[model samples]
Target chain A: MDAIDCDVHCAPDSYEALFPHLSEYWRQYITEAGIRVNGLAHAYPRGVGATAPSTYEALADRVLDRRGVRFVILNCLTGFETHRNAYFGAAVASAINDWVREEFLARDEGLRASLVVSTISPEDAVAEIERVGEDRRFVQVLLPVRSDLPWGHKNNHAVFAAARERGLQVALHAWGRAGKAPTPSGFTTTYLEDYVGNQSIAQGQVLSFVSEGVFERFPDLRVVLIECGFAWLPPLLWRFDKDWKGVWREVPWLGRRPSEYVREHFRATTAPAHLPRDPVLLDQLLEMLDGPGMLTYASDYPHEHGDGLAGLLDRLGEEQRRSVMWSTAAELYGLAGNPAASSRA
Target chain B: MSHVEVRSGGAPVTKRGVELVDCDVHAQATEPMLAQYLSAPARRLLERYGRRTPRVTEWYPRARNAGMRVDAWPGKPGHIWGSDPELMRAQLLDEFGIDYAVLEVLSGQDCYDHPDFAAEWNHAINQWQLEEWLSFDPRLRGTIAVPHEYPALAVAEIERRAGDERFVAVLLPASAAEQLGSPKYWPIYEAAAAYGRPVAFHTGGYVDHRGPGYPSYYLEYHVGNGIVMQSQLASMVAGGMFEAVPGLRVVLTECGVAWAAALQWSLDAAWELMRDDHPRLERRPSEYIREHVWFTTQPIEEPDDPKQLVWAIEQAGIGERLLFATDYPHWDFDSPKQALPRVMDASLRRAILCENALELYGLPRERAVP
Candidate 1:
């Protein structure tokens, strides 16, 4: 079976690595500002500990070749989402996309990319998508999960429309630059609170998409929640379904239960996949989610977790494993006919 | 073809008969009536500036129900459902056969910018509960609402009310200016612990105090409540609130228990990575959660299959930690009998519906005279 790593991350080796990707204007500005580096530190405090020895080349060698991965979608978190200046946000996102292309995708045909965009200006974001949409190597349009408005709000529809036009899935990764506070309550004091709170932001955005009828508006548009824990998905959908039954009149366009929209239009990555205290319960949680069909594999590289796919794969049945490992992502990025769908089996 | 069960008022009873103790039952004060209980200065502040809580944007305008169940509004022209204790009794306590229901008023006391005024306003609301709601029915109990900004006064209120068995716990807004974990809030936790009362977090406060920022819509606001609780849980544990107040217990109301399982995992991992930061923590953070934390089940999360509720309960190890609540007069009230999964185990159902809440509130086990 061909496995797909939907959320493998790589950071710029240095800020200067993006110098070539930036315009002369941004280059001069960044140089003058001495904005020396890009890492998770810009989003939150840095401490992923245990950096994996494997870079993209080694991932191609070890995971793609050895672990039977046909495709690896590279996600770069850095400061792309956190940059406050709209133009700088666009520049940083563009630079990261370009850096990922030259550093990872150019070397490995199996690798794919996300056109990271700044949502500070939807027009700029749409323009960024248009610039990068033609590159078949880029499988999705990426934005930070936290934004000024919920993902379903009309403010974000322009981004979705642009992504839909290109046949690109929209990926909302957890660490976006903070729009206000990381949560509705206010800013968190600790990184631990911030990290755990990211899942809550993801849940709100998912609710927005379902309640606002974003999927109904853009039927072909798909959303993949990256690094947001999937355990919340089953319960969240269930809660939304019940709430919608009582409040559907508020949003008449919603044709069915919130979970129905979720099952069809949305997909999630299993990076920091929670292992319920009862391992059997984890299997059952997936069952409530209609099995692993809605889930795609993600290794969330450089983040420390003892078990990734091995932990989940051991509990899942064969069909569920096949779906989670490759086929689901294969269809998601429209990679079915491409070499990304090739199999060892 | 389709098999589903629907009941008008609530669910039909099953054989393992045990009455429930609802941990979260809201009672709103009728406007001018609560003003009567307030001190003169606080009353003037209320009349002049209204609530001074920071306002953030909320995009989804509340439905005509005002984000409440349509049927919840009291039939009378001016009054809302939660405003009248007699109506609340007929609808919630009597309908569900709840033996004991904790009365937490949505006073908007936490919204006040001035600590003294907030303290007085919350005190008046608590007094209004005793005079208005709790006096109406013995089955109804009250929680001392304290202005979190004024810790000494908050503790004094807890100490003042601790004498009355009718007041079983102290209520604080989940999203506060400072996390409930901070040293500033510890005095309040200390008082609750001293009184052998749990500090309960009922959702909703100043829109600005809510973490992240204002949610664009009410639906986003609703879902985001769980996020606020998760942050508080993490902050309280990692920031060493439990370690500081050894006897304190925390009840997370409205925030569903199912989310706790995922949170427990995150907490455990973070503690392992940053154990040194919390030198006082004796065991893993999840252990503190299971031991000290209790979750009320309203807006109770329902998976597609009935068994997933049991799975979530099992995952959180909160069969005993879960307390049943209706969140009376609110939009998403869970009918005690019908709300839980149909296939739930008799023992587990009994535990969630009654025994757990009794143990948490230090209430007696005897059934109410029906």
Candidate 2:
């Protein structure tokens, strides 16, 4: 099967790896400040096998060749999205984008990358998107799923506008902003809670996007949720559609059912399948979720979410499997019929 | 007017031969009613603020009739919707042949910044429910409303009401200052468990209600009910609170049901990958959830295709744990007849509508159709 791996992660080998990409001032600022990117330690921990490839050869060896994926979208999260200092965050984000381009995209024919942006400042995010979004190899703009404010807030609209203007889809990958509490209540006491809470945060973002009129404003925008599970979508959308009927007047800009907008606008990576162990129930869930239309295949390489994918694949029909594994993401990222695009770039 | 004649429009709900137990029926508390029970200092605060304290601002304005059904208002000019117990009995208990209606009084007192005031106000609300609503009807039951932020006071309130059979559970807001499973809240759980009353976390609180921040619209806030519930559930499972208080049982009310199955899967899968993160957990995360938690089906997920709902319930693997609720008087009330899918199995329907709640709350199984 020719699969499009929608979410494969990469990171700088070390802080020094980003030095050449960063401006001289930022390089000095980081070194003098003794700053470090903790690799989103709260989420990825230290030794639970969530190590991302620091180079293109490693990613290709691990995901492309081993997994036989036709294409892989490289998501390089430098942990700068949650950085407290806005200016420093912006500089680090720019460096991460450059590093992703020069190291990953420039090396492999099967590689495409997401432009890293500082979520703290929409103006800087837009500037970063405009700078690298024009690169055809850069197919989407990457934002962390966890943010100080939801991406749908009007304040962040410019970042979406910039991505859409440059014909880039937005990918909200899981694990972000360690400084911020993972749950609505407050901080979690364990990593298990913080990690599982990512899906809940993803749910919040989806509601934010639909209810805050982000979809209405950017009709053509497509947002893919990477590393976040998709099985939860059916129920969330069901509630969303029902509540919108009762409260549509509050968000008057919406012209259709919230589920309809979500179905049209959103796609989710299938790494953390979050599927029932029962085959019958898994089939039922896929049917409820319109799996063929909404799910995109991803290895979420180096993050060891269990072997639920085999069960998901077994439950899917041949055509539906093809759609989930390849076509849905191809259409979502405009990679269909463009086999040579990555090579040419 | 006869009880059956005044039912809000829908097919007859009590046709099935099972008892109907509404797990979530709101009994709105008015300022004057609650102030009557408070101490002088708290009473003065209540009188001065009039239930609209700076801490309890309505950031997410509900869409219709202040989040209540227009017809739910009592005929009296100044009476609030769902305030008059006779009207509630006529509309909900008698109308639908409900054997037991567990009253959830969201007094807005829990959000008070002043701990002393919050504790006093919540205590007053509990007293108000006992005298004004629960005592008014034989079918009604009470929840011990608590100032959850101040766990010591919450524990005290639970202990004070421990002997009351009319009060079936302890009520805590789903959104709180910290996740309900934290050590700070263990004392409240201890008190509730000591008395054999399950703690019910209903949706609504002063917390921002989203991990990110306040959402732009009430629709988002409405959708956030499930999100916050999932967070709390994950917190409880991971914080080892279930291990800390083995007798603790939780009922998540008015937070949609379908998300539970998905959260279970996510928790189990993540626990597999990250088991070492929390060495305190003796079993898989889902095990604790299945053993300890119950869910209420109010504002039930009504998918476009009813069969999809059947699939969701099956996926949730919690038919025995499902508790049926109407969220009566709220604008998005789920009618007993139409809330669930018609395609559901007869046995499952029995469990959801009556048997499950009976097992959870230890209510009498006799059909009390007035």
Candidate 3:
């Protein structure tokens, strides 16, 4: 069975790579400010070999051809989501979207891209989503996990609404704004804390989405947590379901258990899999998580998380393996007519 | 100690013949009650403000009865839940057959911006707990509430209470202005270790409880408790707090347990990638966690499949480290009789419910049931 990589990261080599896509005003602004895309440098430090493919050809060579995946979704995180200035953020988001389209999606038939949006302003984010979301190749709207407020807040609901209207899923990728504290307490002193914090932050987002009734408002809206570990979900959902039972009146719109909403609406990319090394334990965890239904394959190229994927796959049944490796993501992105079937046709 | 009324008739212990230790039991204190233990200047300040300390704005509205179980409240007018020791003993200790219950008074005084005022408030809370609650019940123990933001003051508070055998742990908020593991707070850890009192990071505090600003509902805030605990655990592991104070033991109370295994795995992965960044004398993150940290199973993670919950516990490899707790008087209190999974091994169940806490708090194995 062919696999579908849900979170293959792509970025411009530098700010200069986006110059062609950017307006002259932003071009000059970026140049003058000496703005460079750090790309989770704190979390995925340079010395640890955390580089992404800067071009489609490079990505194709590195992941597509090597991994033998049927489809790969390109998530372009150019540090635009962290911009403080709304206008600058919007422009950069637009440029990154445009750059991903022309430089990656337009070049590869198998490639689909996530629409980059400015998280600083909901209106701007919605506009960006609406503008670029018309393209069938753009399967999801990409938002950074780190934000001034959670994505489920009513103020930010429009972004999700816009994506839903455009038939685009929202993908919250790990390692968002560096300015925001990784933890609720405050800034983390080391890279390890900041890195592990992605999973923690993802849990908060899941709670926010469920508690704020984001699913109730947009019943069909789906979310994918990319690079955020999936192992934490079962426990988080357990807690969520338990807490919601006591406080369901507060969020009366939630007609069902929070876990039910999550199971129906959410999918997570399996990269940097935080699974137990013991196969028996891993299998038990998978059973608890309903992993086949929730997880999709993602190489998270150039980021080394050891051989967790192999261990995870070895623990799963053939059907469950196929679901995680291909069908789940294929169904999620609505990737109809597999190339294998189409080629024969 | 002042004489307090006791109900001679109380509910029978449910877990008959089983050793039970409750790791978390809040002994609530009202403003006027805490004021009695405060210094003259602090008492005047309390009167001037009409409250013991400035209330930190709780952005999200809590559940009914201010997140307290309605039944746990004393029937008397103006009395709060867990305020009357006799009521708590009837409802929690005697009723549940809890051999030892660690008393934590979450006064929210530690969140006070004024260092001096915060210290005074925490000191008052400690005194009140000792005199009123601890002295009232032989089954009860104390957790020293300190102004954790001010380490020197926190160290002094720990030292002052170090001689008291009743105080089992030093209480710090899970959410704080800085990660509890930061070097700035190492002095507090050192003091806790020196006294052989484990540092317990309980759920609520002054710090924002969600990573992405504040949440919209109390449900979110409640769920964020686990997230905050994960972050603190990671911070402690990465900050080398265990290595800095090798004897220092940490306990995460009222935070969910199942997520710890995943967090440990993620930490181990990240440490492997960024080991060079932290060279403070070496060990895998999970090793340190397994060796040093303990988790209280209150508001325990109840997965649909009971077996799955057991698997999660086993995966965490901290079965011996699990301390059972019933967050008494809270709306979502876990009952000692029904909390642990029936599927869990008898030995592990005993370890979580009684033995682990007995060893951690250095309590006697054979305490007479009151």
Candidate 4:
């Protein structure tokens, strides 16, 4: 019954807590944006959602400990700490990773953090990944899905290259900053536009990266969608395949069908599922997605959303649940490479 | 007696040709004929007082009426359905082999020229809308447009076209004329019920139309505009439109499935709390709504999201009434061929894609596409 949460949001308190103290330049960006995050934006109230290692200990004690959760993959949300000008995004990311290392992963053997990347600039994002690239504590490089543009645009290749070079997973999460999608019906579009952050951009990003042959160029590189609802993925994949037929001849870099690229490279999670725990249905969904192999469970805990231990148990069987709980993620993050699984502490 | 999809495998899982119902297509009037329906005395008085006489040009460009073929039109697809609707039908229906699609008025919805002209415009559009459907666009069907602002005009218009039988349903914004539940608008609903016409309510921003604060691109606009349908549903229920006009079926378009369920629950909850307010209502609000309110899951995004369709059906409690739509010629057009979820049983597909809509609108099934 061991469990692992591949998709979890962790943030920090006042921007200063992560950096402790920042240079004059970074502080100016935060002040100028006039950003006011709504209450309940992240996992915790007093701290960035999971800035403290104790956050993992608490989650283990509350959810995994009882459910036998052995590890939890952490996707930090400090990317939310934004600025109007692009300069500070990288600085904030660098400082936040340092804090995540010192706090959440400092002692929690079960913790695997996805280092946050600033959308503000490509060079800064690459540098931050390089700075923390050597640590086993970080497995994926997180990017917020926020714009209307496709992710394959050559301007983004630098970021994609950095991710490939570092052997890090490119995981896309929607922070609450995506621009709107055009829909005349205007009833809060279900899939791409349904959520607060742009799910459309996330789909577009996934499509862009694959269609551009990011995966084909770097075969070992893997991509994941965290906290992305399951419903939008299938149709979008179909669309990706359908649209690429006439167009990919123009974008010659791609060696295979976009859907084929996704099947070979991509993974998605069933977090924040709209339906309450329905095991029979969830199994069918996993099968459709290519099997339980493609999915790993993450109960966005503390918030009622993750629904704590009960909801996690909803989808688990004696053995299958155990894989998502720890083993599969163990394989994905190259966790088997770590001696930590054997560590008594 | 059936094993659902397996037991009833005869239904079509996919359609050939352009088998569609552009559920919300509109047809506008040509020149003075449309204006002739409005109140001329009111027009003169308003003009005398310096109120701008509303012009048709404001909402429509003359180019829309120009007859152009669908595949032939280049650039933006906005002009695809040009002046000759018969051409649109020929291309989309007869040419592409669309079984049948419903055609509504694209414009001329507001301020009729005179009651008689309103009656005639309503009659002619319904007639033209039907003829347009019946012509080369063999796949087309009529969706009668009503003068939502004037109920008597709407009733007279519905009655006049009632004989043709091509008029599928009476088209009205759930919240048109600002006084929907009031007694003033009951006549039209009554006429629709008498004639077995269902009421189709598409989310019309007859008022405000702005996107969410950060809609930076085309994607954002698609999600932001669909919210108005909720307001339409709310006003329709709060106004007691369903109860006031029993047997008057309603279809809520553009609003996504999740909200419709919420509205159904909220309306029922309100009915319980304020039963005295609606003495005329025979049953709970949700009961009437679930019975009467059908929803079009068109421009349907999140087709892969496993529960989206199921949740919508559960919420409306109208599995038979949830119709499939592509919102063709829009940024997020869903090709029904690819959009139908794998789990959607074959019967549900046929029922949602055409049967329910056809039954509600009284569309001819034989002439749907062939």
Number of colliding residue pairs in model 1? 13
Tens digits of per-residue lDDT, candidate 1, B149-192, equal 78888888888899998999999888777666778889999999
Two-way DockQ contest, 2 vs 3, winner: 3
Q: Between prediction 3 and prediction 4, which has the larger TM-score?
A: 3
Candidate 1 vs candidate 3: the TM-score winner is 3
Off-target runs (Cα >4 Å) in candidate 4 are A19-21, A24-67, A148-152, A178-205, A211-213, A238-255, A276-283, A306-319, A337-345, B1-100, B104-319, B322-354, B363-370
Candidate 2's iRMSD:
1.3
lDDT of 3 by residue, A205-234 (tens): 888888888999998888999988888888
Once superposed on the true structure, which residue ranges of model 2 sit more than 4 Å away at CA? A79-82, A336-345, B1-18, B49-57, B367-370
Quote the positional error of residue B196 for candidate 1 in Å: 0.7
* Least well predicted 10-residue stretch by lDDT in candidate 4 chain A: A183-192
- Candidate 3: true contacts recovered, fraction: 0.83
Docking class of 1: acceptable
User: Mind listing the fnat for each candidate?
Assistant: 0.38, 0.84, 0.83, 0.02
Model 1 agreement with the true structure over A4-75: per-residue lDDT tens digits: 788877777566778898899988887788775645563434455533322566666545665576778887
- What is each model's TM-score for chain A? 0.91, 0.95, 0.95, 0.78
Residue-wise lDDT of candidate 4 within B1-370, one digit each (tens)? 0111221257543224222455654444454333344457543543464322254334422222221223434344333333356545544444434465665564535543555444555555565555444554545556677766778778777887777665677787633445344456678778988999777766442422222222222222223334445444444555567766767887766545544543443345335444554466667656766777787776553433556555445545677777766544333445567666667677777777777776777665443112
lDDT by residue (tens digit), candidate 2, B94-166? 7887888999998753575577887888888898888888788878899999888888888888889988998
Candidate 1 at residue A10, lDDT?
Answer: 72
lDDT by residue (tens digit), candidate 3, B123-232 = 88899989888899888999999988899999999999999999999998887778888898899999999999999889877656546777878788888878888888
Reference-based TM-score, model 2: 0.94
